[model samples]
Target: MLWYVLVAIVAILVGVVIGFFIARRYMMNYLKQNPPINEQMLRTMMMQMGQKPSQKKINQMMAQMNKQMK
Candidate 1:
């Protein structure tokens, strides 16, 4: 009975490790295949780098970026 329980525990642990690796691999591949970007995402990232961006400044920057993009 003790041996059976140990084997079950080991199996469960191995399964958990495999699942974690599979999920991480899938996520990494998916992200590499599809790199996402948008103005809002860039703004959020910039805000996180320092202070929160004001709406006025954000709007101004958005306009500038739009002009540049065009």
Candidate 2:
């Protein structure tokens, strides 16, 4: 009846909230363990673009990327 319908709606809402948090935590852990980019990848990309990759430049780019991520 109407009570069953109400319970179903509440259960669905709770499930959605829990699922969102679970997914968010998983993504944060995954990103921490496997960043989307790395120094080597940056070097290769710079080489493709014909820009000489230097340690200082690489470090600066990494810092900027990390700052943006936060």
Candidate 3:
């Protein structure tokens, strides 16, 4: 009975180690296939070429647009 218990414990440990390696490999492969986007790069690019408005300026512009629309 004691030998059986030890064998079972060893099998479980081996399974857990195998699972960890498999999960790591899968995650690495997924990231390699579909890399994450860098939003900051997009933001920086737009800033270099497009209009950059501030909160107060945007508010003022909105007020002016409302008056003009009316």
For candidate 1, the 10 contiguous residues with the lowest summed lDDT are 30-39
Candidate 3 global CA lDDT score: 0.68
List of clashing residue pairs for candidate 3: none
Candidate lDDT values, in order: 0.77, 0.95, 0.68
TM-score for candidate 3, residues paired by index: 0.55
- CA error at residue 10 for candidate 3, angstroms: 0.3
Sort by TM-score, best first: what order?
A: 2, 3, 1
Q: List residue ranges in candidate 2 displaced over 4 A.
A: none
In candidate 3, what are the lDDT values of residues 1-70, reduced to their tens digit? 9999999999999999999999999987886565443344444544687857455655565566446544
Q: Write model 2 residue lDDT over 3-66, tens digit each, in one string.
A: 9999999999999999999999999889878999999999999999999999999999999998
Give the winner by TM-score: 1 or 3.
3
Model 3 weakest lDDT span, ten residues long: 35-44
**Full candidate order by lDDT, most accurate first:** 2, 1, 3
Clashing pairs in 1: none
